[model samples]
Target: MSEDIDSRRDDSGATAPAPRVAVEPTPQAPAGQAQPGPEAATPGAATQPPFNAGNPYAAQTQTVAHTVVKTKTKKLPVFLCSLAGMVVGAVLVVALIMTGALNVNRDAGTATATSEPSGGSQTIKIDAEDTTLAEAVSAKALPSVVSITAWSSGSSENVMQGDDSEASGSIGSGVVLDTDGNILTNNHVVEGATDITVSLNGESYEAELVGADTSSDLAVIKLKDVDAKNLTPIEVGDSDDLSVGEWVMAIGSPFGNEQSVSTGIVSSLYRSTALPTTSGTYIYANMIQTDAAINPGNSGGALVNDNGELVGINSIIESYSGSSSGVGFAIPSNYAVKIAKQIIGGKTPEHAYLGVRLGTVTASNARQNNLSVNEGAYVGEVIAGSPADEAGIKKGDVVTKVNDEQISSADSLIIALRSYDVGDTVTLTVQRGKNEKKIDVKLGSDADAQTSQGEETNTDSAEGAGNGMSEEEFLEYLRELMGNGGNNRQ
Candidate 1:
């Protein structure tokens, strides 16, 4: 074999190829026979000994990775469920806010705010003149106004016996005219009174009667045990300056409530009504008419002008019964102040009287009678020996004016005459048969007229048949006859 290999490598030191030797074939083992060799004994061979049989690290590592992957994959659904729960919770919260289910109370808070609002804008601004006038009047007048209560016996007789009669209390208003506690009120308030009390700012005090004038329905009372400190006197205003539809304010006790205030305009001026008094005498006079709410307790209250000055005293309400009928009457402050001064001075003031039964000359009556003076007071009758009779005033004359003041109607004449007193000379202008004549006549007292009528009963009765006396005149004649101590009438 070596020689042959050397011959093959002859030209370039090449070794000869090995000779093909005829080798015997190896014994063919069965397909399942175990092989015996170093090849068979390798680690991965089936016949090899197991070197790492006790340890299964490789397989265990693969098993552990697969388990970790499966466990991670299983957690996705849990995470998704948790996220859906959070979304549901957020949606519920949003729905709750969308619906209104809250409660709030406002009136409970307002009840606690007791102080009035002072900083708001005013609806109307008071002018300097108006403010000055109000300040000047209100500063003094508020303290002068007082509330009065008079308790009277209900029994017509035995009123002085306080124990036998039922007590009925009346509420009214008053004005303090001076610093000496002299207060002015209506006569009707103190009439038949067993007890009288005055109140100011919620304080009560006893009042003593100064005097009373039944004809004018006025009375004066003095407060006891009180000094007039800080008392404001009401400013006196001229009623003559008052015009119809002027703004006015009424301050008084209305419906037994004190310090009640009402405002209205003067509806009419120079009004007249015959109010019946407790003494069975008629108070025939002039008054101012207003639409202000004047209840039963508002009598004697002050009717103030827009300047807050005293213009009139609330006297009566034109009602069917004892309630207000939207027509309130007030006595002019001119007359009230005059009567108050007289009462304070201890002088009994007498009312001026013109002894004549007068009626308004209506348009129809003026046209039918062809009267010389139209729209004037038609003198129906004149008392004998009276002012008109003494001044040569005839029964057929019509009064057109008194003392240069034109009498638009009978009411105007009456209002004008109220300003004068007894013994005052008044010039009367009368028209008779197209002749206007002025007659100067002295006024007499109302008492004088009553005395004169009392003395003329039989003469009036004898002339009643020839005078075309109506039923009302015949009744008046009979009343006068009875009052004059005539034996036939009673």
Candidate 2:
């Protein structure tokens, strides 16, 4: 019995205790309050909860909460870091600009506006005032400028010397003044020219002499078979308006150099100089002075204004070395137009002859001749039966003025008379024996008077009515009266 009891006890001890019924404690709202479905266990206490089928989503709620906490912890740092980086970059850029490391010109905006391209605007901004002047002048004046070439055969003397007998050629310039191919040039350019040719726009044609005034050093030529289409007439400007220091331009063939251009200002005005024409006559008086670089071949070229109008014609240059010395003289376009009009109208330009030989009235001449007027043209001799004699002008009359214009010297009177025609009437202010007298006289043609005088003298001498002198002696007497007595008989 004791052994069986002990075996049972051992079996009982080996067997697990009776399964304890697990009862979930109610959830406590507070520390001693009645609990709900389940109760919370105290710290370090173990509790068993019965399987109550309630709160099915409780486990899922806990998992979602835990996941949200982990996401916040990781993403917070990355957002803060990106924000900080952007702020730092912006600060650095501002600092660089503030420091003097960057250069920005304030005037860049204005310059950029000016650099824009012009769209078909006719107006252009020239660099200088004179540049604008040259542009305006060249545009209108270049068409009227013509190039001239003259050729003449060598003389018989040159042919017999075993040299080339070919004709020598020279080049100059001219200005087209009319639509009918009437051109104006210096007399020296066409003088002794046998074959004269005028060129314009690469075409050349033979020319004919219309008339030449040696006293004014002006000549007019006409081109055959040329019309208004080939000719560009120049606009005549007033030279009387030209002031000292006014800008001017010259176009010519300098040194036989074609289409050369030069520019300068008016150095002086109304300058008088002596020029000898190819006809052996001396042209004395009024010229427009400029520094426009006129050379030998530049003679007869046009001096243009800023508006490209013809102001003057390049006539002569005062130089010693046969080159430009910055002293150039031009015949005023005013006078040129007058001469041109006569030649173009088929009227021969006849200068008004005074029939009196005069000299410069210096202080010495005035005292020697007992003249009251100090500055006047002293009358040396007066031709009989001439205009002066017909007007009661005597040998002792001192001319102080012509019409209303004052006469500075004998050259001034000659220059003034060249501006008139043969039948023109002139009013002379003569100072005779301290009394000024005004006389109006009608001029006569010198050509007709000379021819008549030659015929009459020849007839008188041939009939032995005068001094019984030979033809040579009568010719010598006539030559002496014409103020050229020193040359031997030809």
Candidate 3:
């Protein structure tokens, strides 16, 4: 025997089976034993056990005697007990069937049962809840989306000469603006196009460019010879009230696939970016960022909320592969509509401009220059007779905040100014030497700045002043101002 086991006993412990007991009802109690009366057998009586007094499965009450007898019988096997239980269940099921107690309805292999509530029974229509959020929104918005085809000059000659490869045409998307045949789209989409065609609801209509704002990358076009009843303008939502993580849908012609729909949530808000265009570096500010699949032809399409209201215009996508990488940006509807309204009224679109040459501050540079703050935009020069100069903002002043928003760099300050309209007054928090002060300055117009100073105004236009700088030169200038070394955001 091993030490781990108890080996005190000389032999293995084996015993015979215990005696069995049989219970039998007695006609009378034994001598000197008390007898149970009829009241003792009654349900809920004080003398009865509470659990068994009213139990339906309880056996009848009786005075019983137990007798022990020695036997050589073995315990029943599990198989025998299981078989007996199955037999009892089958018998009970048959009894229920005979008494009409259980009924199961099966139709087309689907089993359904009617249930009654405490008040009454009712009928339910499961199909009534089948409509989904995406389905409903798409139904309401698809009519407002239109596919655009732009034809550049000399395309008619190319077609007449049987030279399809030389035809100058581009595909894009647009949103219907009104019943009078006005459509909203990106300026880059229809830029320099001699002929513009709009395809809506299986019909094509000729369109003419109404106005184009290169700074904001927005344009308006009007359809010719189109019926007013055929147009459906989309409902616009308040982009200022939009919150991050809210559901949004992108309706556009991705890859020229008309009426393509994609869904995503708002990834961020109030984002700023710049894109290199033929005219200049187009500045996008206070943009709504989403993860929706915005592709090449999705520009100027609708970015709508779950309520089927247009919140943004799908404009730009940040991806290295030139395809959607789950990062896209849109122009807020409030600002886009403002520009559209200006264009419709035959007025040029205006952007807020600050007359200052700015540079970003760094820790080492701040220490070298003995500046009080290590972050914020460093004012290199303030234009004379400009808003900053009028407000006593001098050179060497670091702008720390614009209104309530913190300005961490030169690019941020420019982006912040782009959100406001011209002539709007804003409070700027400046760090001059060791003292901080607030100054109120009214913004000026970019259009006025360009016309008044011609090519001499080096003031900040937010997009590098449209001074005919090549793409490489503009990017290099942005690098120095933003302090991002050489990695241009565009």
Q: Considering every candidate listed, which one attains the maximal TM-score? A: 3
The C-alpha stretches of model 2 lying farther than 4 A from their native spots are 1-131, 154-166, 278-285, 360-376, 384-387, 400-409, 416-490
The CA lDDT at 212 in model 2 is: 77
Computed on alpha carbons, the lDDT of every model, listed in order, comes to: 0.63, 0.64, 0.73
Residue-level lDDT tens digits of model 3 in 172-283 = 7898877777888888788788888788999989999999887778999999998876877777778998999999999988778898899999999988865554455567
Q: Which ten residues in a row have the lowest lDDT in candidate 3?
A: 1-10
lDDT string for model 2 (407-477, tens) is 75565566566656677898989989978899997876665443344357324222110102234433333
Q: Which candidate is the best by lDDT?
A: 3
| Residue 197 shift from truth in candidate 3, angstroms | 2.0
Candidate that beats the other on TM-score, 1 or 3, i.e. the better one: 3
Q: Arrange candidates by lDDT, highest first: which order? A: 3, 2, 1
